[model samples]
Target chain A: MTALLVSVIAAATPLLLAALGALLVEKVAVLNLGVEGMMLMGAIAGFAVAHSTGNLPLALLAAIAAGMALALLFAVLTLTLQANQTASGLALTIFGRGFSALVGAGYVGIAAPTLPRIAIPGLSDLPFVGPVLFGHDPLVYFALALVGAVAWFLYRTHAGLILRAIGDQHDAAHVLGYKVVRIRYAVVLFGGAMAGLAGAYMSLSYTPLWTQDMIAGRGWVALALVTFAAWRPFWVMIGAWLFGGIMYLALYMQALGVPVPTALLSALPYLGTIFVLVLISRDARRIRLHRPAMLGRPFSAGG
Target chain B: MLSLSPRGTASEFWRYAAPLLALALTALITGAIFAFMGRPPLLTVTTFLVTPLLAPGGWEALLVKAAPLVLMAVGLSIAYRANVWNIGAEGQYTLGALAAGGLALALPDAPGWAIYPALMLAGLLGGVAYASLVAWLRTSFNANEILTSLMLAYVAQYLLVYLVTGPWRDPDGFGFPQTALFSDAASGPRLVEGSNLHLGLIIAPLIALAAWLVLNRSVLGFQFRVFGQAPRAARFAGFNENRLIWLAMAISGGLAGLAGMFEVTGTQGQLTINLGPGYGFTAIIVGFLGRLNPLGVVPAGLLLALTYLGGDAAQMNLGLSSAITGIFQGILLFCLLGSDVLITHRLRWRVRA
Candidate 1:
């Protein structure tokens, strides 16, 4: 049971990070549907860098850079060029998948140095709770810390107020002299960085190797997590952990030789996402109150 | 600084010219990618765009490939026009094939005439049923169809995998994940003596024409247009949003299903795990490229089909990743969106204030 709990936390870490990033983007009224693509780019970039340089931090940085590059392209197209956010985002995902495949072709099957777990001295030695709480890679702790930081930044800061103002009413925020486009750009880039870090965690710690579509549909799941949280940071963590638990539970079922079909097990995450989305979106008032009003809308200063 | 200014009236000239311009831009960008990959750019570009058309029976093969895309895109264009997004046509297509192909395998002794038509109808019904889930969810529970439909697609894909690997696996063949070869009677007739092109080649255009008629000449089509262009006005005019959503999803899902049926009987000769190669997703691009008109989808489908064949050629000749097709497809969509912006807005040189 302790082992199962440990694996569940490991599984949830990447999702938690990605969801946190998406939460920031949502807070700024920018709906980026290309999180999957950005994650793919990060996976390959991280893998390639790790394989060549054998430097974990550099590889993670490279992954962040690759994700940011893709996010910048998306921002330019949807935010600056005023392209349809949905189509452009879908395009970004397609392009990122193909581009990542191209980049990671030679790196396939090459193993990279996995991150070492940080074991807290006394806490990690304390029986069942120790391994669950104190024995994890630094990324897991970083993810947890970042969540709290994000919660604080979003609720307790001046910049956070401005971001919420922009998201709640972009036109009004624009009239109030906030640089809507620039702020959105910054938040989107930050989101990309978090997503990239999440991808790095996948290649460097989760599985510790490069594979085609290694990120799978985690990016999409993270997008769903944002919606499932009703755009709240605290709920986003719980949602991510819940989904992470579901995924791990499926694996545990297969490992125990459960008669459930593997295909069905593979589909649990996506199905769970759909189910959660429905539950969250059922109340019109909840959606209207919580969802960023200017989300996915193209803004023009002159207008 | 360069800034975009909204036009009082969109330039009609750029509206038509944008796709052509985007096509050129995509070709140039993809050609550069080819060059980066250490392949001859011009040759690669020609291999993608020109070489396929030059080969013998290439046009026939192109038509065969385009049939599914055109069929699916026609439905998608109609739905998109109605402001309903059904991204899970892939799942609908899969269920359609399973429904139709399952019939053939289940009733091998049935007469061909009865089985084929019945299979097609079953396929169509399967698609409608699958898509109706999205309509029901959106109307009854207020779920976003995009995520729900997409999730359903993954579910359908897994379901197909399970069927092929389990109950549907052909017993007589060496252990392989595929159904039995469809009986000769159930197979679609070839359009020509030598080519693999099936009767679907004929049916695709006919469906496109019928769709065109409905979109242009029917009250339902007008409702679709009004809703897509102006949701508030559509509501004010008393058009039922829920009803329109159901209608759009049904039409799109039904056509996608028929496309899947044709693909199984016409192309594959049997259902397999790889029945769909993202045709459902690609058709979305085709719908947008064709200006969301059924008639326009015909040529748009052919152009996309050309890229698929070209991707195969580039893989063989240039040793490029088949993912190049996805890259080019994505580039085209991006370019299309960029060019489309110019239709309603004009770029001007503005000094930083």
Candidate 2:
């Protein structure tokens, strides 16, 4: 049971981090669909750095930087040049995939430098509950902390209110003398950094290796999670855990020598993503209330 | 400091020049990447762009790749114009192959004349079947088509893998994850005597031409345009939103499937795990590069097809990573998206913040 809990957390961390980042960007009414690409770039960068330097900290930083660089490109295209947000985001993801593959060619098959677990002395030595709660690496703790932080910043703070205001009505925010584009830029970068962190977690800890498309459709699943959670931060964690459980359930079923085909088992996560999205999106009123008004719509300051 | 200000009207000149600008910029950046990779920058870039054409049978090969890309892009352009983001053409393509391939395998003794039309029709229906799932979800449950379609893409890919590796594994072959070489009848009539180019090469452009007429001349096309530009206005005009969504997905999905069938019949000769070489995704770039114009997809597809050839050539000649092709494609797309900014806005000199 403890082992199952640990595995679930391992799978859920990356998704939660990515979805949380996307949640913030959505809160600001800017949808960056390049999460997959950014995560790939981050994965490659993180893997490369960690493999070479053996310094997990530097690797994490490189991963974050890689993701931020891609986000900056999205911001420049969608916010500065006023390009279509959907196209620009797609471009970012495509570019990230290509570039990551090219750069990571040399790093294939290399075992990544694993992230260290924080053994909190006596507390970590505790029985079943300790490994379930306190046995995770720093990233798991950081991800849980991030949820609280994101929720507080979004609900309790002045800046968060402004960000939500921009999401609800950017034109009104602009008339009120708020820098809509500038705020979006910052939010986008933060989102990128989080995606980067998630990518780093994948390479350095979760699976601990660099492979082409290692993120698979987790990036897309994370996007679905945002909708599943109704764009809320805490709900994102819950959704991530649920998705993680669903994803692992397939693998476990396969491990137990279930009668299902392996290919079908592998496809379960993606199919599950579609199912969850249908469930969440079936309620028209709920989505309308939670979805940012300007989501996927390009905002032009010049207008 | 430089800044951009809105233009009262979009720049007509840039609308035409942006692709050219993007091309030049792509070359420059990718060239720099070549240098960074420890290859001779100019020579490598030269080989990437020029070697494929210089290679014997290059033009034929280019057409072979371009035909299917243009076909899928034609459908995608229509969908995009309608503001329907059916990015899962790749999955639809896989289903088309599975459907067509299934029929081909079943009718071993089927006559050529009957088999060809049967395969083609099966491919079309197969794609429509997959795309309708996306359309139904969006129209009924209000699910985001982008996510559903993409998620389904993964499912379709897995299904293909399952068949090829498990059920469809070639019995005569030594444990390879491929179906038996499709019978001689399954291979469609070849167009070029020495190359793999087939009937689809001719069919793709004709379809694109037909699409051009429909998109430019038909009332349905006008509805697509209006819905894309202003959804509220379209709703006010009494357009059936659900119907438009269904039509858009069907058209794009059908074309994608046909392209898949062409790939198996024309080039692959049998269904295999390696059947889809990312043509579905590349067609997205083709659709955009052509300015989402059906007539424009032909040239744009040729250009993208060249990149695939160049990537192959560079891999063999320069010993550079074959991923260079993917990198080049990504950078080229970025430049195109970036340069498109000039079409609607002009850069101005700003002295002070």
Candidate 3:
């Protein structure tokens, strides 16, 4: 049971990180559907860098750089050029997938370096919960720390207020000299870096291997999680765990001699996402609980 | 600081020319990609751009490929025109195939004439039913159709995998992820002897013509155009947004189903795990590339179809990955989207002091 719990937490870490990044982007009113593509690029980039240089931190930095680069392209097309967000986002996913395949062609089947777990001296000695939480690698703890930092930054900081104001009303924020575009660009890049970190976690720590199309729609789930949590940092964590729990149930159910087809069970998480989305949509007032008013709308100065 | 200075009509020509220009740019970029892969760029380009249509059965393959694209794009154009982004057509297409395949499998010994029409009808109904889920969600609960349609696609895909690997598995065949080869009774009639082209090819153009008439001549078509262009005006004009949404989704869904049915009956001759080759998704590109004009969709579909044939040719000849097709499709759509900037806005040079 403890082993199962540890595995579930490991699976949920990448999702939690990605969802947090998406939450930040949503707070600034940019709907990026290319998270899957960005994550794939990060996975490949992180794996390649780590395999070549044998430096874990550098590989992570490279992954974040690669992710930021992709997000910059997205910013150019959607923010500056004013292209359709949906189409551009999908294009980015397709582009990233193809590009990663091309770059990772030679690296197929190569084993990735395992990240060492940083065990807490006191907490790691706990009987059941220790191994599941405190005995995990540095990335798991980093993800948890990020959730707290983001929650604080979003609610307790002046910059967070301005960013929130922009999301709520870009024109109003612009009139008040808040530099809407610059703030948006910064937030979008930050989101991309976090997404990249999530991807790196997949290649470096979690799976510790490389595969084609490995990120496989996890980014889409993160996108859904943002809405599932109604854009709150704490709820984003809950949403990720809930999704992770559903995934664990699928694995556990199969292990318990259930006759359900594995493919159907594998699809349980996505089905649960659809159900959650329906529940959220059913309550229109709840959707606006933490949603930025200007979400999904392109901002133009003096419009 | 730069300010908005709209370029004139002559400059707008360059905007519409952007897609063509972008295509040229993509060719140049991909040519470099080929060169990097230790292959002759010109040779790879020729294989990718021209060699596919040169083969003996190439034209037929192109037509077969274009048939479903045209059908789905035409239907999608209706929904897109109404500003209803139904990305779940792929799922609708799959469900249509499932429905038609199920019907064909149930009546194995039925006469060909009786079974074919029934299969087609079943396919159409399947698509409409699947599409109605999106429509109902959007109108009934105000759920974002984009995510709902997209998420449902995975469910539909998994359902296909389950059925083919489970109940629909061919009894006589060795362990494989496919259903029984469809009988002659279930297959669509061939349009030409010794060719894969079927009645779907003939039916596609007629559907396009009907769609064109609906959009151009019918009042409902006018409502769709107005709704898409300006929703507030549509509402102020007393247009029933709910009715329009339902009608557009149903039409798109039904046509997508027909595309799936034709694909199963005309080409594959069996329901398999790979039934949807992203045709439903690609049709979105085709719909926009054709400028959402039903008549224009034919040439666009054929053009995109050429890329599929060409990509296969390049893969076989150049020893490249089949994913090259996806790359080319991505580049094409990206270029088209980038060039479409000229349709409404133009780039201007600002003198920096």
Candidate 4:
């Protein structure tokens, strides 16, 4: 049980980070499907940098920058040029995969230094919960803190309100003098940074090894989680944990001789994601309860 | 100097020229990539793009590879035209192969002529059945077909892995993740004795012809196109959105399944894990690159197949990594997308006051 908790937290960290980033982007009315590509690039960049410099912080920063760079490309095409968001997002994924492979070709099968764990004094000593919650690496704590920070920003701050208003109705926000394009730019870049950080965590902390296609559709899951969470930061956390828990459960069940087919077990988490999407989508009201009106639609300032 | 204007005749040419222009740009970018890897750019380009077509059996390989892509793309074009995104052709393809493989396994001793037709039917039915899940979910519960289809693909992959690793493991062979080598009767008969090209290549063109007929000549095609262009207009015209959704998905699924059936019988000759190397996904690009035209898919499919062949050649001869191919493919798509910008809006040079 304790082991299961640790595993779930570990799995959830990447998703949590990516979801928070996606939540921010969606909050700004930009649905960037490039998260998968951004994360993959981050994974490769982070791993390559960490392996070379032997400095974890610098590697992570580089990864975040790499992710942001990729996100900027997406912003240029989709946000500035007003390209189709869905097609551009798919293009980014393809670009990232190819670019990462091309750039990181020489670095395949290489390993990176594992992130050092940071233990909270009193909390770390508490039996099972402490080790699972308090006893963890810096990135895991950062992921949790991000959820709180994002929630506070979105619901508490004036800037958050402006961002939400823009997402709700871009033209209306434009008429009201809310620098809609600029705010979107900031939010999209912020989202990119977080997604990059998540990808960095996958390599430097979670797996501590680099492989081709290492992100392995986690970005898509993050996208789905944002929808599953109904675009709320708190629910995003729950959704991440739920997905992580499903993943851990599948692995645990296999270890426990559950007699489930290995293939089914492997696909369980994806199945859970799909099933959750169906459940949430069935309630049209629930699905539309918090959607930004202009999500997935490009905004042209004067047009 | 000609004054740059936002609206110009040249701009229109540039817009339509984007796809072709993107291909040129991709070539330049890939040439640099080859140089960076210490390979001769000219030699690498030839091997990556031209050499694949010049090899002795190149035409045959191209036809074989083009078969599934043309079929899948033609079907997907229908859904795409109707604004239905079915990203799960990979899953449908897997299911089709499984069905066809199952049928082949069941009738190991069947006559050659009867076996192939039965396999093709099983493959078609398999695809339709898997696709119906997406249709049912979308119509009954309003689920997003994109997510459902994608998730189903993973399930289908898992199913393939389980079967190949477990019950389907060949008894006579060494323990490997592959089924028994199918008999000649179960395999797709070659159109040419010395090449892998099979009846599926012929089938692909026929499928394209039928797709063209349906898309251009049929009322259903008109409805689908209308629904795609304007959903509200379609509804006003008394077109059923639900029925259109089913039709789009069914055709897409059936074509993808056919691709898989041909792959198993014609090329691999046995069911195995990793049967598809993202062909279904890549075909999405092919579908768009071909402008969703069934006839256009022939060239688009062959072009993509060339990439696979060239990628392999680069890996062997130039010592370039296999990923260089993906990089080239990515660049092509990116350039194409970037070029498409000209289609809707003109780039004008404006003077700052």
Candidate 5:
């Protein structure tokens, strides 16, 4: 039971982080669909750094930087060039996958030092919660803290209000002199950083090795998690954990020798995402209420 | 400093020149990438992009690769025109191939004329059925086709995997996860004496031309343009958005399926485990680079096909990674998007006075 819980948390951490990044970007009315690519870049860079230097913090920072670089590219295109967000995001993903695969070609089939686990001395001695919650790595805790942090930042703070307002009506925010473009750049970068961190969590802590396209569809799942949560940070946590459980459920079924095709089982997460999307998207009015009005629309001041 | 100002009207010159400019910029930047990787920049770039065409049998391979690409891009370009995003062409292609291959496997001894057309029809229907799922969900549930279609792609891949590895595995093939080779009747006849070139080479371009005519001259094409350019206007004009979505999906999916069928009928006469190369995703680039014009897709398809060939060559000769192909493709797209802005706006040199 404890092992199952631990494994589920490991799976959920990456999705949670990536979804949080996407959530922030969505909140600002900028749909940067390159989360998959940014995650891959983060995975490769993090693995490369950790393998060479054996410095986990430095490795994490490297991952974050890799993600931010790609985000910067997206920003330049969609914000400056005013390219279509959907196409630009696809370009970013394709580039990220290619660039990471090129860089990680040598890193494949290699193991890297993982993030060190830190167990709280007093809290770890508690009853049933002790083993599952306390003795995980720093990222597991950092991801949980980020949920609260994102919620607080988005709801209680003046900046968060401006971010929401920008997503809802960028022209209005621009007239009020909130620096819509600059703030978007900041959120987009932050989203990239979190995606990178999520990717590193996979390479550094979860798997401890590098592989091409290792993140698989988890990045896409993270994107779906944003919709599943209706862009709410707290619900994103729940959705991430839920998806994590569903994804692992497939493996468990396989291990238990269930009378089902393994390939079909492998496809469960994607199918589940589609099912969940259908459920949520059925209510068009509900989506309209929470969805950023200016999402994926190019914003120009005084156009 | 440079600034961009609206031209108030689209520039006809840039409309023609944007793709060319993007191509030139891609070559320049790609050369720099080779240099950064510590290779002779010019030679590496030439070897990667140009040398493949000069190599023996290279043109034949390019034609073979371009066949499927042009077909898929034709479908996608039309759909993109109607503002329908069906990015799951890969999945549609896989199902098409599977359906056709299954038919071929079932009736391997059937006459070529009879079996081949049946196979093609199966491929077309298979694609249409799969794509309809996306259309139905989007029109009914307001679900995003981008995600749903992409998700369905994963499912299609797994379905293919299950069939090939389990039920369809060749008994005499020594533990390989593949089906037996199709009979000669099922493989279809080749066009040339000594090349992979087949009837698909002719069919792909012909289909593109047909699509070009329909898109440019047909009333349905007018509806597509109206719907994409102004959805509100299209609605007011009494155009059915749902039917358009269905039509677009069916067209793209069917073309993708046909391409997959061509692959099977050509060199890949058997279902195999390693059937993926992301032709669907790359075709999206082809659709865009071609300016979403069917006639333009022919050249666009060939250029991108060169990337696949060059990527293999670079991997073998320069020991460059295969991912370089994807990087270059992505760079080409970014260049296209950047240069495309010039079609609507011009860069002006502003001197502060």
Candidate 6:
């Protein structure tokens, strides 16, 4: 039970980080749908940096930088060029995947140095809950801590209020002298950094290897989690944990020889997302209250 | 400082010229990437863009590859025109192949002509049914079709995996994750003696022509245009949004399914997980590249199909990774999207205040 719990946390950490970042972008009212692509770039960049430098921190920084670079490209197109957000975002994903694959070709078959587990001095030795709660890699703790920080930042801080205000009514925000595009640029880049961190977690800590298309659909899953959480930070964390548990449960069930179709089990997260989306969207009031008001709309000061 | 100023009306000259500009930009960017990779840019470009058509068997292979792309893109263009984003055509394609392949397996002894049309129909229905699920969710629950359709595509892929590795695994084949070879009677009719070109080449253009007629000459097509251009006006005009969504999904899904069936019976000659390298996703580019016109998709499909052949040639001759094709495709899409700015605005210089 403890082992399973630990595994679930390890699996969920990347999602939590990615979802939190996506949540931030949502708060700013700009939808960056290239999380998956950004994540892939992060994974390969992280792996390449870690493999060559053998420094986890440096590898993570590289991953974050890579993700931010991609986000910047998206920002330029959508913000400056006034292109369609959906199309530009899709292009980012496609380009990210292709670029990562091209770069990762040389890094295939190499094992990344595993991140060390940090067991709390005294609490980690406690019975039952010790390993589950106190023993984990640093990234897992950071992801959980980030949820709390994001919730506080979004709910308590003035900057957070401004961000949400922009999401709710961009024209109004623009009227009030908020630098809508500049703030959005910063927020989008932050989301990219967080997504990159999540990708780094996948290659450096979770799986500890570089493979083409690593990070798989985790980025998409993270994007879905934002909507599933109704764009709330606390709920995003809970949703991440739930998905992580389901992901590990699939493996655990197969290990016990439970006769479930392997493919069906593998598909549970995606199917679950659609099911959850239907359930959530049915509550029109809740969606109206939580969904970013101008989620995919482009804003230009001159216009 | 530079700014983009909207013209009273977009320049007609640039409307036709932007795509050409985008293509040129894509070539330059891709050539730069090749140069960075230590490959001769000119040689690599020739190999990837020009050499394939000159090589033996190139035109036939290009036609074979292009058949499915054109079919899928034709359907996609209609859906896009209706402002119904059906990204799950890939999933629909997979399901169509499954349904058609299942029928072929069921009637292994049937005559070629008899089973072929039946398979195509089955494939079309399979795609329609799969896509209807998205339409149903979008209409009934207001679920976002973009995410739902994409999610379904992943599920469909896994379903294909399950079938190929489990129930459909060939008995005579030594544990290989594939079905038995489809009988010759179930295959697509060839266009030439001992060539890969099949009936898909003929069907693609016919469908494109039919689609063009429907989009340009029919009341329903006008409704699609209105819905895409102005949703409020469409609603005011008493067009049912939900019905339009369903119609769009049905048509696109059905065509995608037919493409899948053609690929299985006509090209691969059997069903496998490797039946596509994302013809459905690539078709999205074709639809956009063709400016969402069915007639335009023919050349768009052929252009994309060229990349595939070129990519393979580059992989074999220039020692480039197959991913070069994906990179090139990505660049093309970005260029296209960026160039669309010229459709409504133009670059200008203004004096500082």
Chain B TM-score list for all models: 0.96, 0.98, 0.94, 0.94, 0.98, 0.97
lDDT of 3 at B81: 87
Clashes of 1: 0
Steric overlap count per candidate: 0, 0, 0, 0, 0, 0
Q: Write the per-residue lDDT of candidate 6 for residues A66-154, one digit (tens) a residue.
A: 99999998888888888888778888888888899889999999887877899999999999788997898888889989999999998
| Winner on DockQ (1 vs 3) | 1
Per-residue lDDT of model 4, residues B207-240, tens digit only:
9889988998999999999998899999999999
Model 1 DockQ class: medium
DockQ of 1: 0.77
Candidate 1: regions farther than 4 A off: B349-353
lDDT of 5 at A77: 86
Best-to-worst order by lDDT is 5, 2, 6, 1, 3, 4
TM-scores, chain A, per candidate: 0.97, 0.97, 0.96, 0.97, 0.98, 0.97
Candidate 4 residue-wise lDDT, A1-303, digit = tens: 777788899999999999999999998889888898899888888888999999999988998998898888788777766767776777778778878887787777777787899999998999888988987899999999999999999899998888999999899999998888778888888888988889999988887777788887789889989988999999999999999999889988999889887777999988898888888888888778788888988787765
The alpha-carbon RMSD over the true interface for every model, in angstroms, is 1.1, 0.8, 1.6, 1.6, 0.9, 0.9
Provide the global lDDT of candidate 4 against the true structure: 0.85
Please write out the lDDT profile of model 2 over residues A253-279, one tens digit for every residue: 999999989999999998888888999
Stretches of model 5 off by over 4 angstroms after superposition: none
Error of 5 at A166 (Å): 0.5
Candidate 2 residue-wise lDDT at B288: 90
* C-alpha RMSD for every candidate: 1.6, 1.3, 2.4, 2.3, 1.2, 1.5
- The sequence of per-residue lDDT tens digits that candidate 2 reaches over residues B1-353 is 88877778889888778888998999999889888868788999889989999998899888999988999999999999999999999999999989999888888778888898889998899999999999999999999999999999999999998999888888887888889887768777777575797888999999999999888899999998899889999999999999999999999999999999988987888888877568888899899989999998899999999999999899898787777777788888888988998988778898895
Q: Give residue A56's lDDT in candidate 5 (0 to 100).
A: 89
| Per-candidate fnat, comma-separated | 0.73, 0.85, 0.52, 0.60, 0.80, 0.68
| Alpha-carbon deviation at A94 in model 2, angstroms | 1.0
Sliding window of 10 residues with minimal summed lDDT for model 4 chain B: B1-10
Error of 5 at A273 (Å): 0.6
